[model samples]
Every structure is written in C-alpha cells, then in structure tokens.
Target: MTSVTSLPASEQEGARTSPEDPEKLEDPEKATLSTDPSETSLPNNKRVEQPTKINWLLTCVGLYLGALLYGLDTTVAATVQASVYEELGNLQKLPWVGIGFPLGSVAVILLIGKLYDTFEIKWLIIGSVTLFEAGSALCGAAPTSNALIVGRVIAGMGGAGMYIGALNYISIFTTSMQRPIYNALIGLCWGTGAILGPVVGGAFSDSSAKWRWAFYINLPLAAVVSPLYFLNFPRYNPQPEHTALEKFKQIDWLGAFLNASTFVLFILILSFQGPIWRWAAPGSIVLWVLFGLSLISYGLQQTFSILTSPERRLFPIDFLARRTLLLMFFATSSAAAATSVTLYYVPLFFQFTKGDNALEACVRLLPFIVPFVFFVMFSGGLLPVVERYAPWYFPAGVLMIVGGALMYKVSPNTYTAAIYGFEILIAIGTGLVFQTGYAVVAAKVPAHRVAASIGFINIAQIGSICITLAIAGSIFGNLGFVKLEHVLTGYGFTDSELRSALAGSFSPVFQHGDARARKLAIEAVVSTMGTSFALVFVAGAVTLVSAFCMRWEKLGLQTTAGG
Candidate 1:
C-alpha cells in the first residue's frame, strides 16, 4: 500500500488507481480501508486499527431483521387504512399517514448519509433504531389522524436513516464481493415485509387486537436486535478533531434544507390533486408553483452557495454528472416506475376485471411476490460470482421488457399459468436490477463519498415511485371512469347510476342489477387496466434503452485504497 505522504491530495481524498494499474492494488479487504480521517491524516498519531472478525451469520440476521422494520409500517398501514378511515371519520387526512414518513425521511437522508461517512456508525444505527421504536409507540397510541401522521413522519426519518445506515454498515464489514449478498438479503426482507404488510394488518384488524398493534409490533424485535448492533459492529476513529462551530460549517445545511423542502412540496402537490383538489384548482396551482420554485432554488443553491458549493453540494453533482451514473439513474427510475406501477395495478386486474375478491386477488399475486424475493436473493448471490456486472445488466433489461410485454396482454380470462409465468419473469428481472445501483456505485465511488452515492440512488428510486404512482393514478382515474361511464350509458344505466359508480369503487358496478351492464363495466375495467399496464411496458422499454448507456465494468476482487 502507498503511504499517505506519497499520494497527491486528490488520491488522499478518494482517487483510485487506473484500471491499467490493477496489478498494484491491495487485497480486496485492504483495499476497503477505513476512511476515518484521523487514521490517514495524522502520520505520527499511531492508531493501530485492526479488522474485527464478525460472525457474518449473526450480523446478517440482525441487519435483515432491522431492514424489515422499514417495510412493515407501509404495508401494515396500507392494510388498516380503511379501518383507520372508519374510526377517524376523516378520510381526507389519510394520505398524510403515507406522506409524513417519506417526507421526514427525505429531509434527513442526504445529510444522514454524509454523517455516517464521518462519524461513529454504531451510535447512528442504534439511534435510528431507537427513533423508529419511538415512532412506532406513538403511532400505536395515537388517538387522532393527525397524531398518527406525525408519528409516521418521525418513524420515516428513522427508516430512511436505517436504510442508508444498512448500506454503510455492509460497506464497513463486508468486502465488495460480499456486499451484494447482504444487500439482497436486506432487499428481500424489506420486500417480504411489504408483501406481508397488508395481510398482517388484516389479521390484527380482524382480531380483537386493534390495528395499532401493527405499529406496536416493531417494538420487541427492535429491542432484541439492538444489542447485536453494539457487539458486532466495528468502530472507526473519528476524523481529525474540530471545534463544534468548525464542524457545523462543514455540513451542507442549506443544500440539505433546500432539497428536502423541494421533495416534500413535490409530494404535497401529488397528494393534493385527487383527494383534495383538481389539478386546475387554485390550491393545486399554488402548490405547483411552489414546487417549481423550490426545485429551481435548490438547483441554484447546489450551483452557487458556499454551503452547497460545487465542492460540498448536497447531491454530489460531479459524481452524478458521469454518463454511467446518469444512465444508472435512468435505469433505476424506469425500472422502479415499471415495478411500482405494475404492483399497484396487477392486483386490480384480478379484483376488478375478473371480479375476484380483494383477498383472492392478493393470494393470486403470491406468484409474482414470491418470485420477486427469490430472484432478488438469487441475483444478489449471482453478482459476486459474475466477472462483469454489465453483462448481467442487459439480461435484466431484456427480462423486464419481456415480462412487461406479457403483462400488457393480460385480460379477465387470461390463463392463470400465463400470468404466473409473466410475473416470475418480471420478478427475476427486478431482482437483477435492484442491487445493481448500489454495487456499481460502491465499486466506483471513493469510500468518503459512498454514503452520499447510496443516498442519491435512494432518492432516485423514491422519486420514481412517487411520480409513477401519481401518473398511474391519474391514468386510472381518467380512463377507468370515462370508459365505465360510456359503457354504462350504452347499456341503458341512468346518469345517476353512472355518477354513483364513478364516485366509488367499481366493485359496485358488478354488484348492480342488469347483467349486461355489469358485463360492460367489467370490460371497461379490463380495458382501462390494460392501458395502465402498457405504461409499465413503457417503463421496461425505458430501462432497456438506458441499459445501453450503462458501461460494462468488471467487479475485481482486488481492492484499492479508500476505493
């Protein structure tokens, strides 16, 4: 290994050896050196750091279980939304329950990632878990819609922190090759919690237990796992000592605030459009303008301000400016957009078009859900073995496109086997792409910038999910209602019946009198959903196109200093 004194400042900060110099790099473990500033900067300050031997199995169990906490809230909350609405009698406040956590999470994610980069990770992990537990307690005990929403937001911050913290944690302990395995496990756990969330919520909702138990469930698990965090987690020496005021100046507070505000407002605009106001309504227009201004201001801040100057930009513009990263962003966004939209609508296809009950549709979705987790784990396992990640990128794109195309052909009477095959295809495709961003980013970025890089990737995924859901909702709202109204009127259903049907769930249309009218309404739903799924195909196509620009890179086991 090269001495710190021998390298240039750029190298010290996070420069890597040229690919031509691969033979000169350290063993993979040595290559992933702790980027603690105190270790590198103080030449004579003899800090004899040594690697901590971890029980990887115990570590994996603790980490994946912690990962599940983030997903449980969303899934469980979604399941109990109806009961919540019934009990609270304020349906308008319901969306806030969803909005609050992500908003709080977005606010802190960018900064928190950087914090983990330079601080004691153990405390951060423990604190985040404690925060999550605290929020869960509040939600379980909340007496009003507003109270629950507030608790959700607090917990969301903790979750966002946990997610990034998990990434940082793996990077700290596991070699580059081992990271995908842990990432896969974490992704699968999160995915499992999500798939099971509604079911668990339903169980509690139906049982003598209150829906609040859904939130409360997190308590014991968190309590049990926190001890492992302290015992097994490695420690890093803090960066060169600085006074409180000096260290405070180092953070990009302005940039973080601006970016957080912009995302929150963006979510607000989407949340308001349907539940509260029309797009053309004054409230919508006002929020739209606010969102636009906030975004523009954030961009300017990143470009100009000292707090968010080019050197310390909250988003790390130079890193993201690379063609490879941009394409990755596009690929992830398109894939997430595709998967999220499909996940949102596929169950509807079974429920509305085929008239399966909600529970039955959920059960039918198990094929897709099960394969998704399997492939996510499978792909994670595979990445470590593959010589080049780029080769796998193409197949991921191909499978997503193929799966999405098949999904587009779905109808009320489509073969059960066909849908199952299509879902499995998509699931496998998703698993391939899901971890690509994290692994590739880790491979490319310097240790100092790793957390920031992961956070950026996280933001892209979240942004796509939010935007895709909103667009999908709009399309479903516009197309479903229009088609049903036209079909119902054609079948001699009165305008009043059409109005009532349009205002609520389409299930009633099937329940109403007149068999012919029901048939038309069912057809209308199928047609509308087909159009929606077609957009998912579009998402797949976008991913395929973007994959071309994502450069092929080999995952070398040899590590480089602070790489």
Candidate 2:
C-alpha cells in the first residue's frame, strides 16, 4: 500500500481505485503512519484514523444492536401468532403480521441505500434508530391486528436502514483484511438474534406480559446502546458541497415508486390468490395486472429516467447485471427463502404435531439454532483464511437439499428424534451462506459503489423473505383449511372456524372436537406443512445452480490507510 503522507494534499484526501482492477487487495493490519488530517475521508476516497480500541468496541456494540434488531424482528412474530390471535380475532389478516415488516423494508430499502452515499451517515443512523424504536413501542401498545401490522411495517422500514447501516459501518471503518472477521461477527449477532427471536417471543407470550412484551423488550436495549452511535461513529459525507435539499433531490422518486408498487402488488396477489379469492377472480386479476405494469414501468424508468442520473438511481441496475453479481443475487435469494421459511414453520410444526404451547414449541428449535449459529461464524471465519467464497455454497446447497427432502417426508407419524436431527442439516446449510454475500459484494464492486452493491444484494435477501413467506403463508393457511374442511365435513365447522384454527392451535373448535376429529386435524396440518417444505427443497436446488455458476477466485480486500 502507498503511504498517504507522501502524496499531495488533494491526492491524499481523494485516493481511490477503480472497479476494473483485476487483483484483489488484502489488509496488512498496519497502523496509520500519517498524522495529516486529509488522510481521513469517505469510504470512496481516503480512510480516517482508527479510534481507540475501547471506542471502536463501543461503536461496534452500537452497530451490532441494529443487526440484532433486524434479525429479531424477522421471526419474533412466529411464535406469538397464537397469543396474538387470541387477543385480536381477525385471523383472516394473519399473514399481514409477518408480511408487514419485510414489505416496509423492501419498499424503502433502495432509497435508503442511495441516501447513505448522498448524506452524512451519522444523522441517517440516528434517524433510522429512532424510527425502529418508535415502531417497537407502537407494536407493544397495539390494540388490534391492523395496528400491530402497521407497527411491523414501520419497524421493517427502519430495519432496512439499520441493516444497510451495519454493512456500511464495517465498510468505512475496517480494513479489507479485517472485514471478513468483523462481517462474520455481525453475522454471528444476526443469526443469534434470528434463532432467538421465536424463543423470546414464546417466553413473553407464555408469561403475564403476553406477546406485547416481545416488542417492548427492544426499547430498553436500544436506549442502552444508542449513545454509542452518537458518540463514536466516524463522519462520512460524500458530497459536502451539496445542501441537504439538493441531496434529497437526487433521489429517483419515479423508480422508487415503481419498485415499491411492483413488490406490494406481487405480494398482494400471492396473499389473496387461491386463499381469499379464486385465481380467476377480478380482484386477483387486477392485482396481477398492476404488478406486471409496475414491474415494466420500473424497468423503463430505471433505464431512461430523466429525473435522476444513473449514479443517483435507487438500484445499481447496470452494475448488478455483471455475471458474478447476478449469480450472487440468485444464490442469496434462495438462501434467504430457505432460511425464512424454515424459521417460520419449525415452531409451528412442533406446536401442531406435539400439542406444545408457544414456549415449548419454540424451545424445541435448539437443534436447528445451535448448529446454525455455530456454522454461520464458521463460514465467515473460513472465507477470509481460504479467500474462496464459491466453494462454501456446495456443502450449504447439499445439506439444505438433503434436509429439505427429509423434512418434506416428515409426517405426523415421524419420530420427534428424527425431526430434530433433520433440522441440523438445513441449519448448517443456511448459516453457511447467510451473510457471506455482503462480503463478496463489497469485494466485487468499486470502492465508491460498495454501498450500492451491498444494498442490491440485500434487495434479494429481504425481498425473498417477504415474497416466500407470503407464498408459504398462503399455502399453509389455504391448503390446511381445505384439508381440514374435507376431514371435518358434517362436523359442522364454518369457514371462519377453520381459518381461526389454522392461525393458532388454541381455537375453540379444536377443543370442542372429538378425539377422532383432533386426530384428523393433526394429519391435515402435518400434510400441509410437509407441502410447504417443498419450497425449501426447490430453494436448495436453485442454490446449487448458483454455486456451480460462481467464479472460483480468491476474494481480496482493498482499503485506504486507516482501513
């Protein structure tokens, strides 16, 4: 690496390498030798001095809190469904509870990505944290199902910012060589929070505070870590000369609107089609048409938008069109779908098949969670030393395929021991690739385009979770209802009764049913759940295609002086 002090002031403050460089760079772990203030700048240019070890540690804590919250919110509602259904009886809108968060995230995430590059990162972080905390409070205090869903959407929007911010912080503050370690650590926190979400939700639901405290718990932790963000974060302003209003004007509003509407319409179609309305119904047809139109408009607008330059577009449209990055996006989407569907259904499986309460059902997931947490760190650690990102996906894909196949065969008759064992394979598989894609994107893009590249990959990650969960929910709810109706024919259950039973095991109809009726209901649920796992099987298969398509190359890091 060149010494910053030897360069002229202008060069020292704005040194950068283009994305076309063939050789990958790595960190030497050297201390900054220059005392010049110009050495410190934005990630696209120069890096600043390192904070004291204690100060960096505090900053990391603040950053990891965002990651934790992002992961926690992903599945906290999984185990709380029954408790929520009991308190708020609109079981018809149940999928919205899970869909709301990811919807909010996918809608605004692209804009948030562009904002990080255009404005000072510190204020954005503060604003995002404030939104997340406020949303958490609203969720805890919500009086109805609709209110709860609205709160979740707000939290998801904030979470989209925080998720990108976590990666953004690591990108700016650390050396490329050190990034693998730090990125792996963030993955550790995120995976831990993800698996623990259901456990915490279950615990809260079983206690006197009920499901509401599941959200309330975030407030105290956010309060504790927020000061670190304010005090320790490095300032980054890419365009200091531009006013805030000018920066805001650079956003591609048309592209953003089209992107958001496209996603919203697609999810609506999935949520309603074949469940609430027939596929040929006018309502479904209208949603499908709007979704297609929105998608077409987004593409056209992105390609020829007069409102914003290519640099200011919400998505890194041309950049991600590159072969390697495109493969990464597909692989990432599959991995995300596999993980989200598994996490959402595992607890529900135990609850339905074993007659377990929310707490017991969630606790039963340790088999999957334990290995998942371990291997996520393992993959992150291994990637840096080996410097090979592609091969890791092989084992991940194989394990997920095998696990998904085994899980798909799981009936109500399957042994509990076997079910527990089957989960480990999928857990190990998913944990291997969950966050590694971010590191790869950072390595692949130009220094200035790292934020946009990472955000684009995240679009796949968050979008898959939203789309797959909506599809999976539709499958589970509708299929299970049909099967239950067939079995309980002449038992005199209404459509609402069947739908309520699908939402939670605590429905009064289930209690009123005879032993024969209960037995048939369990069969219906297990079979429907087994069908849902087929999506996991397909995800694993698609992941293998990505793994084989990836380039077998070492991922080298590039960093400025302090970095």
TM-score to true structure, per model: 0.82, 0.92
Task: Summing lDDT over every window of 10 consecutive residues in candidate 2, give the lowest-scoring window.
Answer: 25-34
Predict model 1's lDDT versus the native.
0.65
RMSD vs true structure, all candidates: 6.1, 4.8
Candidate 2 ranges beyond 4 A from true positions: 1-16, 19-50, 557-563
lDDT of 2 by residue, 122-206 (tens): 7898899889888889999999998998999999999888888888878776656567667877877877887888999999999
Best by lDDT: 2
For all candidates, the clash counts are 0, 1
lDDT of 1 by residue, 142-234 (tens): 899989988988898888778777777776555554566666677888777766665666567656786888889889878787777766654
